[model samples]
Target: MFKRLRRLRLSSNIRELIKETRLDIRDFIYPLFAISGNGIKNEIPSMPGVYQMSPDVIVEECEQLKTLGIYHILLFGIPSHKDSCGSEALSDTGIVPKTIRAIKAKHPDITITADLCFCEYTDHGHCGIIDTKLKTVDNDATLEILAQQAVVLCSSGANIIAPSTMMDGMVWMIRNQLDKAGFSHIPIMSYSTKFSSAYYGPFREVAQSSPSFGDRKSYQEDPANRKEAILESLNDEAEGADILMVKPALAYLDIVRDIRERTLLPLAVYNVSGEYAMLKAAQTAGIIDYESVMIETMLSFKRAGADIIISYHAKEVAKYLLDRK
Candidate 1:
């Protein structure tokens, strides 16, 4: 009876009827690049159409995204200062804090999530507080700052605090610290299996969070392993991460699917900047239609089991979905 699977694709109606995956505006989380000043919206040269915008211009960007029916946003803030410890990450007066207030003020309906990492605010651009003697990011020292940063982000109206730092025990630390600081309701999205991939290069250009000295291979996962990702995801889940993410979605779809099959928790895939840049580059070269390729790229994540997708292309993809109807 199952002799001919090709029959299913024989007609458009039949193909639609048998379709296992579909794209939606709700599945997207727009990653906004927030800068430290007003009246500015500078483009990230590596990432076409992605910009580093001032708070005022960012509000305008939000309005456009809202009009496209994109509801979720993840913020990466560029602060005016940096230090060895990245203290600005926790400051109520910092770029992230101020931008969260601005976004919430303009659109109370939008779900604002803050990227809870210190790279954007650190001189050395390490994700944690570093120990120069050992030339390593101190796990305990980083957790202390992450907890405070979580509380401050919650106070500033971040609906979700996503810890992209791959530090051990970070989820429990933030969860415990937030609960104790009266922000018990705030959710923590942990980047459980962020691999050290070349796919993050354009993102570094966009967020400007690249390390000034050493690379992040010590903390981020090595791209060569899959079993390690499962172990890390399980660890984060047990430690109270409200959601788990596998970053750089395209190359890591196997891990995304692995996590999806293994856990009940909602899964997120970061369609990282470098991945987007590749598609953008190809589309510009007339190799493929941008909108069609973009839709296919996103729905691939859905088919592989991403419940939410944090993407730089969310706005464009959302608009495409809207026009389809």
Candidate 2:
């Protein structure tokens, strides 16, 4: 008797029944860029369809996202001003905090995950304080600022604080500060194994956070190091991270799977802007089907063991899933 392995491939219904991995609308977390202004919804040139919206516009966008069944959003702020210490990130009236309050006031049901990093707030475009003399990011000083940012973000109604600085001991510091500030309920989603990659090129443009002088290689992990990635995730878990992330997901699915095996905490993978832009460019050139490729790429993340997917494609993915239903 011949083995009927082709039986499952015989029909679409059979394929769906045998599928081991599935993508859900709830698995996606959309990212938004919030700028300091009113009635602004400037599209990021490098990332098509992604915009830097004002607080009012952000609330409007969130309402739409809610209708699409995308309740979670990760916010990146572009302040109108910047300083050496990124003081605005800790200010009560800063762009992120102000945007948070606005979103909550209008849509209290949406969950906001604040991206806690100083790169956008600092004039130098580095993730943290710069040691002027040493010509490098001062890790300890950056930790202090990150902690303060976390508290302020939590106070402003952020349901989750995602620290993407890749600084050593940042998770512990933020966790400590949040508890001390009486925000013990807030969870920290640490970017545990962020790689230094060219894939972040488009993101730097959208966030206006490219380093003015040097690359982030000193702080972000090298893409070549697999063991180091796992170690980073382990350390963050020990430091009280509720969720751990592997950034630039397409190029690092192995790292995502490795980290997932090592920790019980939820794993999030960032499908960075460059990845989205590349696919968009391909589709525009008539080289591929945009919708089908987008769904396949997102399912790849889920197949690789990602519990949460943070992507610029979130809105599109949600719509596609809804259409399927």
Candidate 3:
């Protein structure tokens, strides 16, 4: 006897109910870039929808984000000071610490995940306390600073400390330090499969984190390598990362699916700034219908085994998804 499997494929309602993958508003983490100031809201010309907002404007932005049913946010800060060691990264009055305090005071329910990195704080735009001796990312020194940053974020009411510096043993160092600092409840979301790709153009503009002298090929993963992705994810997991993320999601959906096969941890995919800007530009040029394609891109991320999506498009996608209902 032949079995008929086309029954569920007969209609859209049946297909939806039986859908193996579904995207939701809560599955998103909207990324916010904060600069040191009170009222400035600088629009990133390269990335059509993102902005580098000051602390006061960031609070107002959060209010709009909350109304869109988006519950999670990832933060990147632009400091007022920079040094060879990125000393401001550990400062209590740093851009991120202040913004976290302000946002938490206003929107207590939002899951605030602060990006822990020294790139924005370092005058050279390196992501750690650099080693002038060997001229590379000093793993031990970076781990110490990363740990301190995590605790600072936690003290500022950040629920998650996302270390995007890609330093060796960073997750373990951060976890141990947070535990010692009484921030044991805060989680660490490691940007484990962060690739050194050209796809980060728009982010550099939004974050103002481009290296002053050289590139990050020494630390970020090589895009040509796939097995390295698994190794990186495993390292983060073994080091106590609560969640693992793959950056520049569209190009690495395969990596996302592969990493999904190896870990039970919650996986997040970042629809990076470049990807969003490119899509927005194409839509402006009438190459595609922006809203429809944007939603489809997000659905594709869900289908690719990403448990969370970090995107600048979160608010717009949330609105579109809501209007569809």
Candidate 4:
């Protein structure tokens, strides 16, 4: 006789009792884009529910997030000016640094994770300074500025520095500089396995970071190379990253699990803009149940061994989980 496993499947309560993977509101870190202005909350066309909010508006957003019981946020800056070297990123008074200060003042309990990358600040829209001859990013020069950027964010009350430049030795450089500056307690969340993918199209619009010239293929990993992806994350771990991330999480759940198995560090995954947009579009088209699909997508990340999820859908997920309780 066959074992009646259907007995467990019959009741929703039974399913909940035996569920192996679950999503918590605390597992999410919502992403916010801060521009240099007041009363600005311009929604991106491609991404339906997301917006580019100014510092003052962002502070108000924090208040709402607190009500939803979501306390963590990932902040990105959209500077008003840009130079070849992304000098704004190193400024003590730049968009992101100032925003972190403002957020901490009003919402002292909120945890801020400031993103450390130059693409949105640089005029060329590259992650860092470029080589004139090679026409590619100068990795060593970028590392120096990234270190300075990290310290700037930390000094301005950022609890974590997330480096997404995909530069070699980036984690080591930032960690050393942060320690010397007496921010040894601060954690570094490296975007370790970011790939050069088409899924980033919507992000460019909200970030205003589209490359003025060629693509970022030289630095970002090729999506086809699985071994290289794993090695990149492992290297970041060896270089003293406090956390490792697999970006564009849906297409790379295997990479998330692979890194999770190899490292003891907390693993994070980015549910990128394009992934968010696709689900929203399908919902708009009346093709799927948006809430159920979104919950399942988030559950997939938790099941794939991601300890943290940086997602645009974070707020919605938080509300959904709260309602279920």
C-alpha lDDT score of every prediction, in listed order: 0.90, 0.93, 0.89, 0.95
Q: Candidate 2, which ten residues in sequence have the lowest lDDT sum?
A: 1-10
Model 3: per-residue lDDT, tens digit, 83-134?
8899988988889999989988888988899998998889888898778877
Model 2 alpha-carbon drift over 4 Å, by segment = 4-9
Per-residue lDDT, model 3, residue 42, is 88
Candidate 2 lDDT over 1-325, as tens digits, reads: 2357667346888788878999998988999999988999999887889999999999999989998999999999999999888999989899999999999999999999999999999999999999989888999999998999899999999999999999999999999999999999999999999999999999999899988888899999999999998999999999999999999999999998998888899999999999999998998899999899999999899999999999999989988888989
Model 4 earns a TM-score of 0.98
Compute the lDDT for candidate 4: 0.95
Candidate 1 per-residue lDDT, tens place, 213-281, comes to 888999999888889988999999999998999998999999999999999999999999899999989
TM-score of 3: 0.96
User: Considering TM-score, which of the candidate structures 1 and 3 is the better prediction for this target?
Assistant: 1
Candidate 3 Cα errors over 4 Å, as ranges: 1-9
Backbone clashes, each candidate: 0, 0, 0, 0
Task: Encode model 4's per-residue lDDT on 190-242: one tens digit a residue.
Answer: 99999999999999999999999999999999999999999999999999999
Model 1 alpha-carbon miss at residue 91, Å = 1.0
Is 3 or 4 the stronger prediction by lDDT?
4
